[model samples]
Target: MPTLQIREAIREAMREEMVRDDKVFLMGEEVGHYQGAYKCSQGLLEQFGEKRVVDTPITETGFAGVGIGAAMCGLRPIIEFMTFNFSAVAFDQILNNAAKIHHMTGGQFSVPIVFRGPNAAAHMLGSTHSQAFDSFYAHIPGLKVVSVATPYDAKGLLKSAIRDPNPVIFFESELMYSVRGEVPEEEYLIPIGEADIKRPGDDVTLLCWGQSVPTALAAAELAQEHSDLSAEVIDLRTLRPLDTEAIIASVKKTNRVVIAEHGWPYGGVGAELVDRIQRLAFDWLDAPVARVCYDDIPFAYAENLEHLSIPQPEDVHAALRQVAYRD
Candidate 1:
């Protein structure tokens, strides 16, 4: 095993997949000559050259449409949005073509393409650039949504997403790019629908993925240190197939749950999970499910206000205590 940052792990995954299959190519703004907007594609241009490592104009709709068309023609393309918030520009292509072609053609064609890049807010990027779109893509029927929290998961799950026979929405966070964790040097894959129990406890369940995963883990530590409470943390790595079984099992053990997310509370991922949890594990719950999330208002441009609006350790801790009846 080797320790690598989330960005390094992602670069390795793309590089390996490109080497393994010539049909696999990368095209996005600043990905080629400039390495990448975030430098996640560094050295790829020098190794794979301009043909495989391509640079495109700052046009999400055009490039994304091109990627979908390329996939329909049997080429695997990795389409990177500078930030997933930009994906709003290409929502038509993704929501209509990439998600419908397989079924529209009666399984005759599949979009084996991966749409990836940083998601959610970073620093004081303002409301427009700070939005998290996981719930948007995950809501679609034909897309596979993956949000990885660890470097190991980033590498393994990315490999699987690249090879998946469906359009995959791969969400990363700029904040997590530099976070390092142990990843195996050997090639391996994690199944698309599996959830990993990042931390185990019997007092309550903290459900989360992607940018909110670290918050869940940190909240668990706070629960222990301050309240003498234990919290089970489950990372729902893939949102579409959503490992509800894992969530239910943890809910049964803990009899309480707190759903954390980087998005707003209304119609967010947390809301969806709460619906499922209530439908499946309602009888097991000791307290009503609670959510720790961003305030419903638009993200603020000021750093201090944005910090308060976004869910933090104390917010999750409060949710934990609320669910556990320790508040």
Candidate 2:
């Protein structure tokens, strides 16, 4: 295995899929001559030529619709939004057309399209650019939602997403693009809708995804060191079609759980997870399921206020402690 950055892992997945299938093409703002908004597609323009690695105008809705149409016509299109916050402009395309096309056409057409790009907050990029939409897209009926954290998962899950014959919302984090992890030199794929237990423990289960995976791991470490608490951290890599079995097994083992994510507390992804936990795993739980999510408010431009709005490792740690009755 070779260590690679999340950006490199993403670029490799696209490049490999493009070579394996000529129908697979990447088109988005800043993808061609600009390499990628986060340099995730560096060198793709020269390797695949301007046609496959295309640069579009600053029109998200226009490009998204074009991608959906292309997918319906037997092409595998990967549409990148500079930031997922801008995906709002193209939500109508994704929600009404891309997602519903297959069922609307009665299996006559399948949208083999991937909508991907940086998601969640990145440093002090301001309020408008910081909020995450993981919950919104995951709520859709006809979409497979994936939010990747590790370099390995970023590569493997992305390859799987590209090959799937349905609409996929692939989420990458601007804040996680530079994080490095071991990725195999040989190609591999991690099946979507599976949860990975990053670390095993007995006291509590820390369920999380995307940016919050690292936070959960950190909190698990802190709990072990400071409170002598053994905490399991499970990464719910795919939000939709969630790995409920994995979650239930962990909850049964630990008897306590704390869900974490970058989304707001109100109708957050964590809320749905809470519902599932109580409905399915309630008998095994020792304590009520708790969550660590951002405040139910828009992200603020000020650094300190933004920090307050976003969930952090300390927040997760406290949630774990609260669940474990260690506080």
lDDT of each: 0.93, 0.93
Candidate 1 local accuracy as lDDT?
Answer: 0.93
TM-scores, all candidates, are: 0.99, 0.99
For residues 1-327, write the lDDT of model 2, one tens digit per residue: 789999999999999999999999999999999899899999999999988998999999999999999999999999999999999999999999999999999999999999999898888887788888999999999999999999999999999999999899999999899999999999899999999989999999899899999988989888888888899999999998899999989898889999988888888898998899899988898999998888887777888998888888888889889988887
- Model 1 CA deviation exceeding 4 Å by range: none
Model 1 TM-score is 0.99
Q: How well does candidate 2 score on lDDT at residue 288?
A: 91
Candidate 2, lDDT over the whole model: 0.93
- Deviation in Å, model 2, residue 180 alpha carbon: 0.4
Regions more than 4 Å wrong, model 2: none
Question: Compared to the true structure, candidate 2 yields what TM-score?
Answer: 0.99
